[model samples]
Target: MQTRMIDKQWSEKYPGVGKGPVATEPCISPEYFERERELIFRRHWLNVGRVDEIPTAGKYFVRELEVCKVSVLVVRGNDDQVRAFHNVCPHRGNTLVLNERGTCPGRFGCGFHSWAFTPEGKLAFVPDEENFFDLDKSQYGLSAINCEVWEGFIFINLAPMPKQSLREFLGGVATQLDNSPFSEMKLLKTYKVEENANWKTGLDAQNELYHLPFQHRYTIGDSFLLKDGKYCRFSNVNLYNYHSVWSCEYNPAHKPLPTEALLNRMDSALTNIRFDKRISDFDWYLIFPNMALLLFTGPSGDFFMTYNFWPLSVDRCLWEMRYHFPPAENVGQRLAQEWTIGQLRDTLMEDAFQHEKIQKGLASRACSHMVMQDEEITIRHFHEVLECEMAKV
Candidate 1:
């Protein structure tokens, strides 16, 4: 492949995201992290999981939001409505739903006491009701949380009164991906890594194409189209209010490995899926606070991936990665899908190795700020958004 000439398009388009050094305090200071917990994580809409996880009535899953120290119970009720509630027993404040996920019976029973609640979160039974003094079971129903479904993803807001609905918080991102064929694909694999790094550090590294050629040199260094024979350039960049989408072109002349070439020759069902929701060959969207949606136009099919960075402390975070692909119909197709997972998993492992090293450098106080580049405009814009949100009183 040859080098192509390109201009500083993103910087020119998003001038308000100044081309200045971004401070490291937000990623290093313990006090700053505490502020983020209250002002950012507690207030924004956070994605817990998808509705498919609880497909049938009475099926539920529990998500622990360590940043806010809250456990969320997401379930499908007998009415077939998806709802969320705080996973805390209203009677004695004991943690409810100890398991990660389960199929609820007619009612949920607290193992500590004999209190029981319906799948609809209504208090159904309490031992020796006559002994209580004018107790109202209706008044002690499970504490509900603001939960909403978008496309198939479930989101919960911890705010007493959310400043904006999920649709409003998503802004332009929803408009662009309105009818995306996300439900057509099935989850293929999930990977979670506990990293010794700030949550933002991992997200910032993945948000830009500047490090693709260097950090991922062995795996996907040449996968994206490059400029000046060295740097990868974005085909398009859309900066939304509190969110952003970046698209890049793939190198058409790149060669495939032996297994990949063999799978391409086979009549694999992995190639049967396709959708028209792409802005370029690849699109990466940042759903504000801590989620990322990645769309890929692969040789076999169109697939998508998601990333969630959950903060555990000032210097520790959980990085979750999930891949979704078209359902396989035969053994060959399934093998091909597994191969696709392996390729991406290897590349991401390279990224996971760098996160800890980056955190160590930031903690050393050797550098007060990080210098930005034209291609790293998304990272700069993200920091700008973070600062604006943290400035709220």
Candidate 2:
């Protein structure tokens, strides 16, 4: 199929404000990936893990987004605050945390030189106390990054000084979800998958609903209205500097039977809950440079779920999906909601399979660029944001 160019009329109508040109070469270039690691991933506020993941003092989790060669340590301090530190030891630059996650016995000991650090990244001990003369323990502590938690998810920025705070980075997108039940939602399960594709390729596949009808037909195809879906409801797509939001309600014209039934059960189980089942919506918050946060509200108004993405490399990425439920819901209702997670999992597998094929295709010389349509405004906007950032580098 021939790739469709952005509508000239749309560009003329919005003139100077429409989507930018599509990037075909950069998407498949290894050289571009190297620059991306330096210009984008290293400087952005990357999502590490959730605050709930390390709930107790001394608890810690390591996030290895190796593309940028970044290994971050998310630790819960004695003061009950969560902090992120570079997982490298000061001496010989050995990795401080070897395991994915575990509880630190009051301090983290580097296996290399037995250097110990408090959960707050403060140096506490040295193996040979008298071995090194004039070695200042205070100056050799684990280096820390700017860390913050927003609505339960922990975020870290590697920049010595970030240009924008997490709150400022989130902007109005955070306010739109301020009334959401995310803060109270407990983490039920986490599913991680590594896709063999550029992080942008995986993100491009997710930023739009245009592919749902064609790509996920056997699964969620019937659940969403594709061509018939309205463009400006629930929340409108807003493109900021490097971030974008593609917000809309599920089209009422094509709500599937199973989805409708799920919505009814949701209402019956929750009190004082009212959702316009016909117009149930979700928002896809794309934190550019790299990251996609999918926020969904069930048709029954009983729960919310988020899919957080972290780019592992130029051609690899990791996704962490968490389901959230109300604190008041009974075990039976929560369990029923949990079952929905299975359906989501199936849909994700479907997406992953297609993304891998696209990656292979992009690697081939036969095909060059992909097409875009009005419904794919989200994906188009993403490329625009990426190109803008690349130009600055």
Candidate 3:
């Protein structure tokens, strides 16, 4: 058994931690997971992509969200405003924008009937214009979903009428990270993997730092837990509305692996790169249902990455990791960032490979409840939020 940190127990120190013996049914049950699809995923504000992906007029991309069983087409109009609509053609319901992303010029046309809709989602043309009666052009236009942008990130709500604006939903998260360089930073690269585990199961693994030293022992263990003889405690965990932020102690003196050490030692200039001027090396933010904003401060450019967990089924989810970095000024800078990326990839692969085994274990119904420690407060809070949202209907 791991040594439990009693003094740093957030569940007791903080009043909000939810009551739970975290259940396995929520991980493996199809019926209850369906309730999650209807009650939670559809109603929540879900992050889809960043504005940088579509910077010019008439640029658009189709995002297929399996959780809601709806494909969303996000567009940048001639007016330069970003918007989203159902990807289905308004007439025959044939899918629109077959390509993952492309420039629409002025509008997109369905391949089946050649019905074209403007970037602003207005019905522009149809080949057989004289066939139908009472065909109001305005009525036949593409249907729009509630779309909003925050800090250059695009979020789409499938709710017929969103309960609150994205600003209202994000609350203090906006104020806290308002100054982040999200608008200016560029996408360095993206890594994607499909996990055969419930979305929650995958997300739960990342909400805290307790597992870093053990699960990631070979790759990142020494960095988080130095030869120091003391247990490393998270600096603090702050909860807001339904979202939460957790910061952990970072050892500035933490040594790098042999390859990285050799690279940095060879080029002293690489040490000059700093991910951010933040106090902690890591600040992880969980946005309710499915978004994780993992901000970092490292020896390379100050940038933040995002983890998007898109559910495909009760026991399957598509997981994506996006890496954002400031443009590299020199070869040294690029190599430094690549070094970190390699380590992160290896670490995430470890976590990803284990998720399937966890799913299989949960399927066994080997245990009714999984006991959680004080360090796992965020996981408990996540389950609490899911239970609360699911109970609404």
Q: Which candidate is the best by TM-score?
A: 1
lDDT of 1 by residue, 318-373 (tens): 99999988777777777877877898899889888898899999999899999988
Writing each residue's lDDT as its tens digit, candidate 2 over 1-393 gives 111223343334334454534656776787888888877777778777778778899999998878678788999999999998889998889988999999999889888878889998999998888989899888988888899888777888887899889888877666555555555566676777888877777778878876676677677675553433422222355666567676555555655567536644654455434322212356677777566766666533445555555666556777666665555456555555656677778998988888888888888856667667655666777787677777775
Q: What TM-score against the true fold does each predicted structure earn?
A: 0.97, 0.86, 0.93
lDDT of 2 at 29: 84
Lowest-scoring 10 consecutive residues by lDDT in candidate 3? Answer: 268-277
C-alpha lDDT values of all predictions: 0.88, 0.70, 0.82
* TM-score of candidate 3 on Cα atoms, chains taken together: 0.93
- lDDT, candidate 1, equals 0.88
lDDT of 1 at 390: 97
Poorest lDDT segment (10 consecutive residues) of candidate 2: 1-10
Per-residue CA lDDT of candidate 3, range 229-274, in tens?
Answer: 3445566677777788877655656677788887665433333335
Off by over 4 Å in 3: 1-6, 225-232, 265-279
Best by lDDT: 1
Model 2's lDDT to the true fold?
Answer: 0.70
